[model samples]
Target: MRIRRWSTVSVAAVMTVALAVVLWSSGAPQGGRVVGLGSVVPWGSADPRSPMAPPPVRGQAGPVVGGLSASSVGVLVVDGGRHQCSASVVASQSRRLLATAAHCVWLDGAWRVDGATFIPGYAAGEEPYGRWQVDTAYVPPAWTEANSPIEDVAADVDMAFVSVLPRDGVLPEQVLGAQGISFSTPPQVEVAALGYPALGSYDGQSLRGCVGTGAVEAFTRPESPKPSEIRSLDCDMTQGASGGPWLAGPDADSGRGQVVGVVSGGDDTHLVSPRFGPAAKQIYDAADTAALAATAPAPSPSTDPMSAQIAPRGGS
Candidate 1:
C-alpha cells in the first residue's frame, strides 16, 4: 500500500469516497507510550483502482498449508459485505476480541460500523468455524483524529480492536482459538506475516504467509510530520491482507505465536504496520474491559485454550 495513492486502505488503497471505493478494505488501539526509530526509505504510495493494482506484499508468500494457525486468521467482511479484509482472533479474557488494522473498521473520516462479520478458518468458500458478527469496534483517539496531509496516516494509531457478538452462545476465541498478542513489541523479531491475498492470482479464500525479521520504518517528511515509526517486512500479501497478524515465535504447523504487529500498508516490496505500544495497550484494554462487563456466563471448566473448532480446509 502506498501512502500517496488515494484508492482503498490495504496498506495503501485510499478510497475516501463511497463504500464501493473505501474498498483496499480493512480495521486499531492499546496502551504503552509509543517510541519510534527506523531507516528513512521513501517509497511513494500507488493507485489501487488502477488495473495494475500493486501486489499485496513485496516478497514471496505461500498458503498457510495445514495449520491450526490459519484457523485464527479470518476474512473480515465489511462495507455491507461489498468488501473484505483479513483479521484474527487474539487472546482475551472475554474470548470475543479481534485484532485488525484501524483502517479496516474506521476510514474516510467515519467508522465502517454497518454489517461487520468475521469468518474464521474460511477457505474455498467454507466457514470452518462459522461466522461471528462484530458488535463493537474501538479506535484510539489519535487514530480517529489522524487526518493530515503531512502524515498520510498516524503511525501511532493505525491498529484497532473489534469485539464480536457470540455465535450460538460461543465466543470466537472459544471456537477459533486466539493468537497470543503483546503490546510491548521488541526492537526486532523474526515473524511470519499472514493474510488472505485477494488480488494478483489470489482467490482470497485461503491463508498465506511470509516470514522475515520485522524492522521499524520511520517517516521523516520535509514538512516535519508527527514522529512516526511502523514495523515493516518484505511480504507480497497485498490488499486483502491488511489487518493480518505478524507473529513472532510462530509454530510452523500449529501457527501459535506472539503477535507483534498488525498489517497497515506497504510499498510494492514491503508491508507496514504501526508499532504496537502503550497507546495500543490502552485500546486493547478498552475492548477486553468491555468483554468482562458483558453478562455472559463464565465458560465451562472444560473450556480449553487456543483451539480451532472445525477441521481445516481439505480435511474430511
Candidate 2:
C-alpha cells in the first residue's frame, strides 16, 4: 500500500517566502541563551561506515522498517489531505499531546489550523493504529513575533505542541503509546531520529529512521544576525522528515526513550533539531493544562451495513 505524493512544490514555495521575510528583517546579531545540558546516553561507538554516516543518500534515506519506533511516529497531514510534516506522540498529562516543529504548524505568519490528522504507525498505505484529528496547536510567542528568521532564535523555539481529538473512544496515546519527553539534557546523546521524509527517494508512505549521536552546533546564515545552537547529527533525513522525534536513552528500541528534540531541518548530510528547553517546556505545560478543560466525549464509530455483517465479532 502507498499514499499519494504530497505537494512538495507548494510547501517549498511557502518556505521560500518565509525565508525572504526573515532576510528582509535581518539586523544586528543577538546573543543566544543556553538551554541546558542534556544527559548523555551510551549508544555505543559511532559507525563511520554505517548508512547513517555523513554524505547522506538523497531520497534513499529513511524507510520505515517497523518496531516501537515506527509505531510512535506518524505523518502530519494538512490542507485536507496533503502530506505536510512529521510528528510524534509524546508523554503528557492529557495523553493527547503531539510534538513537532513550530514551522510545520505555523508558517508565513499564520497557523495551519484546519483539517489536520495524525496517522500513527502509518506505513505502506496502511494506518495501523488509525487516525486522530488535531484539535489545537500551540507555539511559542517568540517564534510568532520574531521580525526575522534568526537561526539561533528559531532554533531556540522551533517547537509546537498539538492536542489530538479522540476517535472511537480511543486517544492516540492509548492506541499508539507515547514516548517520554525531556529538556536540558546533555549533548552528544545517542538517539534514533524517525520521520517520513518526502523528498529525494522517499514517497512519504513508509516510516524511516537514522541512529547516531546528536551534538549541539551553532548555525549562522549569512543573512542572519547571529548564530544559534541547534542539535545536529549525521542523518540523511530530508524535508518531509521535519518535526520528527529525536529519541534518546537505552530503551529507544522499545519506545521507552525520551524525546530530546524534533527534526527542524537539515542539509543533505546532517539533520538538525531545536534543543528541548524552557520554552518548549512552557508550551507542553500549557497544552497539558488545556487538555484538562476539554470535556468533549469521544465520537462513536460509524456503522457500515455490509462491513458490519461480514466483520468478525469480538476482534480489534
Candidate 3:
C-alpha cells in the first residue's frame, strides 16, 4: 500500500486535518501530460505524483478488524526489486489482472514497467513461493494528468490492473492462480477490504489487520474533487494499507470477493477510495479483454489451470 514518507516533520507541528485535506486533494503530471491528484501515476512521473498522504493516526477505523485474506492478496514489488506496493487479484480469465491504487503502481513518471513482481499469499514476511513477475499495468488516462488533491481527483479512479507472469515465464495458474471480477452493482454496497500493511507485521508489536465489513454507502465525494476518483470509508486502516481491495459482494462461484474500489488514501484514522466511478469500468473492460487473451483457446482443464476454478484463490 501507499504511505507518505515523512521528511523531518515534527509531531507537534504536524498539521493533521489540514494536511490530510491537502494531501487528499493533491495531484501530479505523468506521461508528458497533466493528471489529477489521487490518480495513479506511472513509474515515470518526476515530482508530479505524490504518495498517499495520511494524518499522523494510530489505526484504521470503520468496519475493520484485521486485514484481508492473505491467499487473495500479494506484495507488489517494483521490477522484482524492493517491495514497495500491494495488490489483489480481481480478474483472472486470461490476463491475470490485479486491482490496486494507481499511485502504488506508478511513480515519478514511468510506470515501473519492468521488473515488477507479485508474491501471492505472502505471510509473515515470507515468500513461500517465488515472486511472480509483472508483464504490464494499466492506469486511468485522467490520472496521468496533474491536478489538486483537495479537489479529490483520486477518490474516483484510484484503482488499476496489471498483468503478471512468473519470472520463468510460467502461467499464473501454475502457481498461486488468479481471481474473478464483477461490476454492475450500485453504490453504498457492502464489501471486504484486503491488503498487506508493511508497517504492521505478523509480530505482536506490529498492528496488522485482516478484517471484513458489511457497511454500505459510507459517504460520497464533493461534486468536483480533483482527480474525481476518491470516496470516503469509515474503515480504520493505517499507513501501508493504501491500495487494498474494497470487495463488493460474496464470491458464490469462485468463493473469492468482487472488487468495488481500491484503497488509495485516508485521514488520520479512516480509509479513502476512488468511488469505483466510470474510470473503474473503463479499466475493467480493458482488463477483461487482456484476461480473455491470456486464457485463450476455450480454457480446458488440462490446458487451462484456471478452468476448474469456480472462483478466486483457486477454491470452489
Candidate 4:
C-alpha cells in the first residue's frame, strides 16, 4: 500500500483523517551503488554472557501517564500531512537531537523532505509540548545506496538521527527532556519499546509500549555481501510505531535508562531494530555536529489559535 503524504491540509483535519500508508516499499530500485557490508561493532561495553530472557509477556497501549517516557516520546507528522512516525528525544551535545527509523525520513529511493514536525506527549489530538519542526535528517549511506528489494539490507542501517529547529529559542531536549543512549551492550537485555502504532487494532491516537527481552537475529539476501544482524522483540506494534525508542532497564515507569535501539519493523508477532553500534553512533555524531553549527531561523509572528481551528497548546 502506498503511504499517504501530507498535503496542504489544515492541522485539525490531518489529525482526524485515517492516514494508514504501507509500512515500506519493497520493489526493485532504479540504480545506486550498493556498498559492501561492513563489520559491526558494539557502541559501548559488551557481555556475551548476558542471560537470555523471555519476550515481553506483558504490554500496554494507550496515552502515556506521567514520567520520562511520557514527556520525552512523541509522534512525528512528516511531509506536512502525508506520513506519520514515532520518535524520541535522545541526549545529545547540541540538545536538539531525535532518534527514529531511517525509513521515516528516507523512502522510495529518496528523502521525504516535505516539512516534518514532532509533537511530544501527543495524546488523541493533543500536542502538549507543541510541535517542533525538523531541520536536518541523517541517514546511513548503506540504506541510501542499496538497490536490493530485500528488507534486511535496509534494516541493517535502519536507524537515523534528526535535528529539530528550536521553538521560541528553546531546544527540543530542553522542552521534552532527553533519554540516555547506549550501544555495544549484550543481547537478551530487557527493554521497553514505545511508539504510536497506527495499524492493526490501533488507531494512532495514543502512545503504546511493550516490555521484553531482546534477542539478536540475522537476515541475509542473495544480492547482499553478507547477512545483517539485528535485535528483535516480541511486540505487536505496527506501522506508525516505527522509530520508537527501545529503553533498557528494569523499571519502565521512571523512564531513566539507556536507549539501546529503535523500532525498525516487524511481522505479525515481533518488532525489529538495528542493533545500536558503530553505524548508529556515526549518524548520531554527524547529527550532533550539524545541529551545533545550525543557525536558528528568525522567529515569525505567532499564529493565534483562538481564531484558528486547532487549539494552541504549548507553543505549537
Candidate 5:
C-alpha cells in the first residue's frame, strides 16, 4: 500500500502524484546536485535532489538515455526543491503552456509559492534545453476549494496548467516543440506514459516510458464524496514519474504525440490519470489566455503552431 501523510490513519494502496516526494525524502538522494536556469546552483538544503528518495535498485531500470522527445518533457522542481514532479510542454498559441497534476502545483492546503523551475531533457544531471522558471499557474477552482480530494468530484478535477518564463526570449514550445492535446478522446485506447521515475527498480536520470492500453477506472469506496473514476493502465512508474504525460498515437521518430491523460495515482501494477474533458479544456484555455495577454516571446518561423508540434504534457 502506498501510505502517505493524508490522514492520521493509513488508507488503501495508492501511489499519489506527490506522495513519495514528500514522504520518502529522508534518504540521501541519488546525487545531491542543485540546478537552476541551466547552471548548477550551490548545494544546500534547497537542493532539489534532497527531496528525491534514493533509487532502491542499483539502478535496475538500466542506463541513462536522452532524446529529442525529452526536450519538451521535464522535471518540475517546486517549493525550493522540496517537491519534485514531472511535467511537459503542451501546444498553445502563447507557446509557454505546460500541463501537470494539480497536486504538483498546489498541495497540503496551499500553492507552492517559493519557487518552481522546469528542466527539460534532464538526464544524468545534464540540462539539454536549460531550466525555465514557472511564472503563473492555473488550476481548477474545484480542486482548490476541496478540503480533501478523497471525493470523486475533487479527484476528477486534479489537473493544472502553468505558464513558464521563456529563456533568451524564446518560448519553450518554439525550442523543444509542443505536443497536441485533445479533450474529447475516449478512455479506452493505446497510450505511452513517459517520465523520470525515482524509486524502486528505477532511477530518475533519463526519459523513461511504458506503453499500454488505457481505460476508465472506478473508485468504489462506498462513502460520501466517493472517489471518481480515472484512466488506468498497466505501468510501473512511480513518484517522480507523477505528472508525466500519457501520449496517444506517439511517433517513434519525432517522439511527439497527442496528449490524452497524465500520471496521477495508482499502485505498483498500474497508473491512473484524470480523464481529460471539458474541465481540462477550460483550464488549458485559461492558462493560454493569460499567457497570450502577457509579453510576447521573440518571434521565430516555428511560431506557427503547426510548424513545431512534437510532444505531450503530464500529471504529478
Candidate 6:
C-alpha cells in the first residue's frame, strides 16, 4: 500500500505556518539522533520530543516475507539534534551508497549540514563490525526549494543516497553487504514493507514486517505537496518506520518483490511513501549510477566481513 505525507507530526492537508512545519508530511521525527547511531542525551527531562529508543526487534514473521530477518538488514537513526536521519548499509553501488529519504538529510534549520554516523548490521547497542563515517549526502532538487511540504510527491526524488568511509580496509560486499533496489513501475501484485519503529506496536530493537496488497493510485497532482499515483496499502505502522523500502521480489523470506515505494509520511493512522513511478524511477537510477561513479576504494577482493551517513536540518 502507498504511504501518506503530511508536514511534521500532523497529516492534515492545510498549510500551517513554517514554525509549525517541524515534521515532514510523512509524519517523520522532527528532531533526534540519526537512526542506528546513538542519540545525544539531554541535560534535563530527556527531551520528550526525542524519537530514538532501544527496543526489541519483531520476530513474529520469523524472517518471512516482510519479516525482519535477512542480510539486507540495517538501521536508520535520527541525529541527537533531531535534524537528520542516517541509514545503515543494505546494498550499494560498489558498496558506496546508503539510501534514505530526502527530507532526512536536507538543510532545514540550524541543523543544516550536520554530520551523522552509519553502522551496518548493528546489534544490541554495539557496532559488531565497525563504525563508518558519512561523507557527502544527496537529495532531490525539489526538496531544496522553499515550497517544501506543499510540493510533496511520493516519487523517487524523496529518496536520498550518501557515500561513506567504511571501517578501514573493508569493501561493502566484504562486510554486511547491500540490499538490491528496484524501480519497477508500482502496483506489484503483492509486496511487504519492513522497518524498525521505536514506537507504536514495534518493540524498537527488533525489525518488523507487514504484508500489504499494492496498487497504483492515479489522478492529478493534489494542491498539497504530497505525491500522486502512490502504491496504496493498508498496513498499520507507526513513527520510526520512515524511509523503509517497499520491497518486492525474492530475498531471505518473500521472493520476487521489487522495492517500489518508500515510507514517506502518512495520514493520521497510516504512513505514506513516494510511490515508485517515472519520477522515483529516474531518481533511483540516477542515485545508483552516481554511486557507481564514486572511486570507492576496492578491497583486495576478499570475502567474509561486515560494515557501514545523513543531514538535513529540522522543519518549521
lDDT of all predictions = 0.62, 0.60, 0.45, 0.63, 0.61, 0.43
Estimate, for each residue in 126-195, the C-alpha lDDT of model 5 and write its tens digit: 7878888887677776666663332122345667788887788888898988877889776587777777
Evaluate candidate 1 by giving its C-alpha RMSD to the native, one decimal: 12.1
Per-residue accuracy of model 1 over 143-240 as CA lDDT, tens digit each: 66554321255444568788888877877787788888877767677788787765444546667777777876554322335555667677755566
Question: In model 4, where do residues sit more than 4 Å from their true spots?
Answer: 1-63, 147-153, 296-316
lDDT of 6 by residue, 80-128 (tens): 3332232434355557666666655553522232345555544434455
lDDT of 3 by residue, 266-301 (tens): 544445566665556666666555555553432223
Q: Give me the candidate number with maximum lDDT.
A: 4
TM-score of 2: 0.70
Candidate 1: segments with Cα more than 4 A from true spot: 1-58, 148-151, 220-226, 250-254, 295-316
Q: For every model in order, what is the number of clashing pairs?
A: 37, 11, 63, 7, 7, 65
Rank by TM-score, descending? Answer: 4, 1, 5, 2, 6, 3
Kindly list the per-residue Cα lDDT of model 2 for residues 115-202, writing each as its tens digit: 7778887665677777788877777776676522323235545778888877887777777888889987886788777777644444
Better of 2 and 6 by TM-score: 2
- List where candidate 2 sits over 4 angstroms from the true fold: 1-62, 147-153, 219-228, 253-256, 296-316
Q: What is the C-alpha RMSD of each candidate to the true structure, in Å?
A: 12.1, 14.8, 12.6, 14.7, 9.8, 10.2
Instruction: Indicate the worst ten consecutive residues by lDDT in candidate 5.
Output: 33-42
Those runs of model 5 whose alpha carbons end farther than 4 Å from true positions after fitting are 1-68, 149-154, 219-228, 250-254, 296-316
Model 6, position 275: C-alpha lDDT score: 63
Candidate 6 TM-score over all chains jointly: 0.62
What lDDT tens digits, residue by residue, belong to model 4 across residues 14-131?
1011111222212222122112211111122111221222222454333344578767888877644466788899999899889888777776565654577888887766677888
TM-score: which is higher, 1 or 6? 1
Report lDDT (Cα) of residue 8, candidate 5: 9
